[model samples]
Target: MDTQQLEKETLEKIDQIVKNNPVVIFMKGTPQMPSCGFSARAAQALIDTGENFGFVNVLADPAVFEFLPKYQDWPTFPQIYIDGELVGGCDITLELAESGELKKMMAEANAKHAQQDA
Candidate 1:
């Protein structure tokens, strides 16, 4: 498939992901067993926030690896998205945690999702 088709497919999958799960994490692996150090750290940050989230293992899909970078325009793995928006990788998550912003964002996200569910 062409780049356009691949991009479209990747984004559509991502959209479905975020829509189905309130908090979606497109990281290296499952939250229980992250494939990389960055992914593990990102998961930890999310855990610290005390919110449950969904995770997609890009390592499990070759197409996802080939197409995800183009979708996010980010040359890295362990990408985290909140409410369907990219929130950078492990370093950004660590920074947010150190500043206590990660927890705050998680709380806000949880509240927003709770409102939607209600």
Candidate 2:
């Protein structure tokens, strides 16, 4: 496919992933083996929340890494989304985690998504 078409498809896939999952993290790697410190820390924060989350490993997909920032206006890896909304990167996630807000937010998001699914 052409460059534009490829980018369009990538963006659409990203949109679907973000919308379909209530809690999604677009990071450098998988939750078990993050590619960067930021990703590791961010993934840990989410894991601590005890809420199941979806992740996209940017390192595995060049098109997503190149075009996802435009999709959510987040210009970095380890971007967390709750209810399909950007929740910022590592620092923000850590802050929320420390404040005990991350768990709550994640739970609420999961619950809301579960309701939607049901």
Candidate 3:
């Protein structure tokens, strides 16, 4: 495939991942082994919520790492999405986690998605 086509396909795959999952994080690595401190903290924050979530390891996918910031207009790693919405990065996630809002938000997003799926 051509460069443009490859990028297009990657974007589509990202779109599907975001839309299909109730909670998703695009970080430098997986939740178990984050590549960066920011990614680790963000993933931990989500994990603290006790909700099941999906993740994309940017380090493993060059196209996603190159195109995600442009796609979401968020120029950073460890981007978190709740119900297909950009919920910001590490600091924001940590703040939400500390405030007890992250868990509530995760539950609500999960419930909403579950209803949609049902």
Residue 33 of model 3, lDDT score:
93
CA-only RMSD, every prediction:
1.8, 0.8, 0.9
Best by lDDT: 3
Q: Cα deviation of 41 in candidate 3 (Å)?
A: 0.3
For model 2, residues 10-52, the per-residue Cα lDDT tens digits are: 9999999989998999999899999899999999999988899
Q: Per-residue CA lDDT of candidate 1, range 41-113, in tens?
A: 9998898888878888998977787777877788898887777678888899899889998788777777788
Cand. 3 Cα-lDDT: 0.94
Best by TM-score: 2
Compute each candidate's TM-score over C-alphas: 0.87, 0.96, 0.95
Off by over 4 Å in 1: 1-6
**Predictions in order: lDDT:** 0.81, 0.93, 0.94
lDDT of 1: 0.81
Pairs with steric clashes in candidate 1: none
Error of 3 at 56 (Å): 0.7
TM-score of 3: 0.95
